[model samples]
Target chain A: MPSLPPIRPEDVAVAEKTRPHGAFDPPSDAHDPVRAGYLMRLGDDALILGQRLSEWCGHAPSVEVDLSLANVALDLIGQATLLLNEAGDADTLAFKRDVLDFRNCWLVEQPNGDFARTMVRQLLFSTWQHMLYQRLTASRDEALAGIAAKAVKEVAYHRELAAEWVIRLGDGTEESTKRTLDGLAWCWRFVPELFEVDAEVEAAVSAGIAVDPRDFEAEYRAEITRALGEAGLPVPDDQRPILGGRRGHHSEHLGHLLAIMQYLPRTYPDAKW
Target chain B: MSDWPLWEVFVRSKGGLAHRHFGSVHAPDAEIALRHARDTYTRRMEGVSLWVVRSSDIVASDPDDAGQLFEPAADKVYRHPTFYEIPDEVKHI
Candidate 1:
């Protein structure tokens, strides 16, 4: 056999061209604050929920569930990194931002009350995210489209895993069913806010940078209804619409969450790994 | 739950490879067992395919009979391929 040539930095660079992570070249043009805000909103949703799920790292009911929850959390955090990077410096965006500046919807920031509650919130969010990402894969913004394409597969698994737990618990023992119903009821009110399209959302939709969630409102409702039906549960009555997360108005929960998440970074602002 | 059944997992690392036993997981049922196996063993792209079966379903030989079953074969060197002769041109053998 012929002797192999010494590897060079240039050859390593060429070999890395086919690597998936960090392969997508983000657009270099400056984006107005509005467009940047849109990307941050998407990123915040993943980041906040990822943080919530990570709280279960050492505390989930079983080893199997613990791994599964952490798996999904890592996937969400990975998506958040890509999205926040597109908006600006991902570290600054995630570690330095104040609660009022966060754009994640209220659902993700809700406490992980129990396994049932966690799965309920996950099911509600991942279903909506999966549907939205399916459409976003066709976004006019190439960066968003690429992010969506990769994220859609992860979100699909999240949705399936959540649905599995929701159905199993909802239809299992009486206590499990009661807990599942309580989770559904508590999470139901926030469902409407997910599809609420405000002025900024409208601008993004009009520019083809985002899909109009209103277009799928009926389908979303039907999907929830079907899932609930399988669980032998009823849809909760429509409560007063709890809105304003998009504009940075949030419930008290987000502040507490931010306190813990930002503590290390806030205290030692210049620290690096 | 403690009552949950244990499942043995086998994984095929890639195409054209037979599945080798990887590990096990506990789950309430077959469907969840498959998922638990995937989460537990295949999270790092360790396998392209997974198979999960209830551990109780597997039929394993008794370890106490190991001498009678396997040791006799180890000493039977004449039954082995060590005595085979081949041409210098032979490669795979």
Candidate 2:
């Protein structure tokens, strides 16, 4: 039999700190198990989208754009780590979970169609994240408040970067502008998901663990409108509620995404990387 | 055609310090250049202030003139205080 290596002091300290705080003892009045689950869903949304964006690491239209996308992806991943680690632990939530256990929104799992589509997705998502994080910074839950305060600054930069790209692509040339409009048209329906205030959200907000998603709708719309206007693109009046991901009914894209994301982990079960 | 021009970036890390040359970025105009500098160079809050000047507009000393312009000062030991003594109470020199 092979003997295991001795554990280091740092590893022991980290392990002691991250030991699970008993399964069901909520952290605070605001810390609902259901809402923690919901926060995980939001975190997963950012994680999946960040992973998708990272695929363009070496294939972007320009080096500046490549670096920008990579930076944005890093910011999203940072946000995901905080939220996921809070929900459970970073390692367990990220690596130990099965595909069926993930609760990310469907739109985030969509394929990166083109630069235009990616920009549109980013614009929509960053707009919502900016508003959400801004309000969440004032959350009664200190941990959540801290996370939000940090993330708010990052999401603000993401919003500006995506907004600039949207304008540049939309107003650049006839082909680019047409593509930008088409991308916005395709992505507009999914915008409703950002503001879908489910029961869990309401409960969490009432307890001060989370912000009311509905409260950000007007600001999101205004920011998006300004961005689209500057981009020389018309905001599509898609009022339909194309919702389901929050309830676990996701678009077909999510399954394919999960297959790719979970392949290595599933293949090497319990293996340390 | 890239409408943007390259701009040299200078960052002041904190208060009461001179802006040190950090890097450069490409941007469409001065306003956008400052913004690009902020986004590209100061993402870590490493700077409290920034300055961006068009690279084309900067007047740089000629590399070929290095011998004539700087070599004369290299041997000027009289400009230094090697031959002089400082008082013990002198805090900084």
For model 2, the local distance difference test gives 0.80
TM-score of chain B of each: 0.83, 0.81
Best by DockQ: 1
Model 2 CA lDDT for position A232: 85
Q: Which lDDT tens digits does candidate 2 get at residues A120-171?
A: 8998888888888888888887877898898888888888878887898898
lDDT (Cα, tens digit) per residue for candidate 1, span B1-93: 798999999999998788999989999998888888888999889999999989999999999999899998987888978777888997544
Q: After superposition, how far is residue A208 of candidate 1 from its true place, in Å?
A: 0.9
TM-scores of chain A across the candidates, in order, are 0.90, 0.86
After superposition, which runs of candidate 1 have C-alpha atoms over 4 Å from their true positions? A1-27, B78-93
User: B19-48, model 2: which lDDT tens digit per residue?
Assistant: 999988877667657766776788788899
lDDT of 1 by residue, A129-220 (tens): 99999999999989899999999999999988888888899999999999998998888889888999989988888788899988888888
Q: Which residue pairs collide, candidate 2?
A: none
Query: Comparing only chain A of model 2 with the true chain A, what is the TM-score?
Result: 0.86
